[model samples]
Target: MDFHLTPDEQAFRDEVRAFLDELLPPGRHPSDPEFLSTWQRRVREKRWVGFSWPREVGGGGGSIMQQVILKEEMAKRRAPALGTCFMGLAWVGPAIIEYGTEAQKQRFIPDILDGKVQWCTGYSEPGSGSDLASLQCRAVRDGDHYVVSGQKIWTSIAMWSQWMILLVRSDPAAQGKHDGITCLLVEMDSPGLTVRPIRNMSGTSIFAEVFLDDVRVPIEQRLGAEGEGWKVTVSALAHERSSIAEVEGLLRKLDELVELARASTKNGRPALDDDGIRRRIARFETRIAAMRMNGMRFLTKQLKGEPLGADTSINKLHRAALEIEMGDLALEIQGSDGALEKEIDGGRWQRFALSWPEVVIGGGTPNIQRNIIAERVLGLPKD
Candidate 1:
């Protein structure tokens, strides 16, 4: 694939552009809170904050092309999120360093690389979304503690997580629906959970619903055993398709939809001097350079160890149709000031076209990534 960069990955991309030019020095504003706690304590004293998780779990054991050049130089400086423990550094600390317990990696990998807490993901319910293994939520077990009871819905940041990673059903007669499920780690105050939130349509409650009632948990916060929760959710959805390193947040939303089509205006002037808006922004930069060469051919078959699966649903169905065609061409170049919110890019491309459910139904949708590329990458046949 020889996608260049290998003088030690161009000196690790010049040591991440000299630490973002000395800790975010351009026009400042890395979102402040004491400048993001001094840029998360200078990238957590250079461990580069979970840089690629492995150095005895606190992470930054780099390389995977230096974690794709430190997330493409922190998404070309949109910065802010190296680690605030969002979904506990995505995919619950690599599904607790691959199915936890060594005291769940000394109790949750040093508070998820020191961002303290916050993590949510229960795995859809309300009669299962995208047939998430027909989840029922149950739990049961008991004696050493298990109880649980149903309900999850949407979840994401479950009204400000404290911990979750759930998914239940403990063994309802085991037969199938990915067999008896079960993978815990709960907490959020436990005593019969609750949550609620859910707003969406971009009004944003960042999703929620939860519930539970007989909660409990304990048995050292179960994570692997009991019918192996669909093999710990198929090894945490195969390390969450390395979230195709969000192709640097869709190349910083196509450079803010090309500076909102050069300060928008059509028929009479600019709209990037239209040629059908520069052929739909050059077909969204050729489908974001074919999703960065299909994420570097799945990082060169994960650096040759191979075994990558369903070809990351072919870049998650080409990033859910290039984020709904670049949020409907940024509200069709803001025609009616894109349904106003005091326009001029203020409506934020009409709230990113009403934030399509974390991209047309989070994690799995676009018809379940085209049925995982028509039955596991085209072997086909499974109707």
Candidate 2:
């Protein structure tokens, strides 16, 4: 893939930089409610909120390269995200756009773009995480509604989200486990549905164990046809596995590590002067650059209108390992003090140290990604 940007791409990058200067000036805090509100509003107004979606559905409909340019500029500036709804804009909205009825689009897309609703995915279950098609969350059709009954674990943002893009066994007796699944757009407040938050190692309650006991969902809210959820899942998961989204976050953390190293002393000398520390830092930066290139490859394929496939697993696996490595390296730099809850940077490093699994094992485990790469991307025979 060509590394050089075309003239139009360069101009677009300049445009994004200018937008940042005006709206996200240096020292701006994205966490500030007023600033964040204003920023989201401005980006939404400029149609950069959902820049990759179709224009007819109130999206910017920007080209793939343009989207890359936009995200790159924003990340370089450490600016806030373009939209507030995380899962909504990333995969859920795209899935809806692909398989949802026209009425569903009109009903859901606008809220997603405007960040009026939060969406949580309901794919993983007690029995079906990495092998998602084996999910047994039942959703039996009854008149105009489907009665859902089952449980999902490690459901991120389940307690906070207003909606769930759920997958269930709508046809339990179908020919295969993969063929019996169906996707549903479920409301969090529905009767018989329960959300019990799980306190993770990081001391946060973002993940949850969700139970659906005869939760009635209108058939109209079914995301795709019965027995076709496996296809929908495969497509949505491809988006989930794209590691491009994690690039900016890793870059920011790398910057923090660099700063920490400069301030730290080892053997009565600056830690930055330690050859070992320098090498580890360099290794991280190199890996990050590689992930960036992988991201570009994904973009390149999209530009050519090719379907994204298992190549995304390469980056996904890299990102999972990187998150853990980065966290461990940061704590290593802190030495003995790293173990204390509030030792370095008010325990930010400690929090990061404990937070690897969410990224490492969220979409798919590292082992799972490798299997995908070996068999699907490399054409290696599966044992």
Candidate 3:
């Protein structure tokens, strides 16, 4: 793909930069709640929240290149997120746009873009362990509703989300494990639904164990046709795994890691002066640059209208390991102070190290990504 932008693309890039200049001027505090609220409102008005979704569904209908330009500009300015609903904006919105009914689109897409509600995913189970086809959560049809009864584990933000995009086994006896699965958009407050927050090593409870005991879901709330959830899940996971915004986040984290090294000490000198530390930092920079190039490659395929698939597992695998490594190195630079939760850098590195599950195991584990890449991308036989 050509690296140079077309005249229209250049114009869009300039527009994004100008907008950032107006909203994120010099000396502006990026983390102020009021400023972030205003920032979200301004960007939503400009239709940048769901920039690539269709205009009919309350999106900007921007080109892929234009969306990339928008994120690049926002990250450069260290601006607030485009909107407040993390899961909704990331994959749930895209999944709904691609597979939801017209009524579903009207009901959810607008709220998601407006950040009016939070959404949690109900994919993992106690034993599924990334083999999503093996999910055992059951939903039985009863007239105009399905009575769902099962448990979901590792559901992020379940304690606070207003809704969930859930998967249930509608026909367990189907010939193939992947078949007979169904997806539903369920209200979190529905009767018989329960959420139990699970505190992590980081002393946070962002993840929870969710229970559904004969929860009645109206037929109208079903996301797609019955027994077609695997297809929708594949699409959603692809979106979750492949994000250009993630590259920008890693870049920001790299900058922080560099500063942490400068402020740290090892062998009576600045840690940044240590030959080993310098080499590791250089490797990180080089790896991040390569990831950026790979992102552009994926963008090129998207521009050709090619749908993303298993190839995204490559980046997912890389990011999972890279995050853990970076976190560990940060703690190492801090030496013994790393053990204190309130020590240098406000214990951010320690928290990052302890919070590996969110990044390393959320979408899918590194081992799972390796399996997908080896079997689906490389055409290797399953073990």
Consecutive 10-residue window with the lowest summed lDDT within model 1: 236-245
Which regions of candidate 2 deviate over 4 angstroms?
Answer: none
Residue-wise lDDT of candidate 3 within 1-383, one digit each (tens)? 47998999899889888898999999999998889889999999999888877898888998778888888878878888888888898889999889998889998998999999999999999988678789999999999999999999999999999999999999988999999999999999999999999988888899899999999999999887899988987787666634577788888889999999999889999999999999998888777777788888887888799876676777777687778889999988989988778788677788888887788887778898888788888899998
Q: Evaluate model 3: give its TM-score.
A: 0.96
Q: What is the TM-score of each predicted model, taking all chains together?
A: 0.34, 0.96, 0.96
Candidate 3 residues lying further than 4 Å off, grouped into runs, are none
Compared with the true structure, all predictions reach lDDT values of: 0.81, 0.87, 0.88
Candidate 3 residue 197 Cα shift, in angstroms, is 0.5
lDDT of 1 by residue, 1-383 (tens): 46778798888889888888888888998777998998898888788888778887778788777877777777777788776887777677877788888889889988978888888898888888888898888988779999988899888878777888888988888777798887888988788899989887778788889999898888888888877877876776676635445777887788889888888788879899899888888888888788888778878888989988777777777778888888888887888877777556467777777786686688788887888778887778876
Per-candidate RMSD vs. true structure? 19.9, 1.5, 1.5
- Residues 1-383, model 2: lDDT tens digits: 46888999899998999889998777777789998889999999999987889999999998877887887778778888888889988899889888889999999999999999999988899998888888889988899999999999999999999999999998878887788888899999999999999999899888999999999999999988888888886777555524555788798899999998999888888899999999999999999899988788777787788977777778877788789988898888788898789967899999998999988898879999899889988899996
Question: Between candidates 1 and 3, which one is better according to lDDT?
Answer: 3
Task: Sum up the clashes in candidate 3.
Answer: 0
RMSD of 2: 1.5
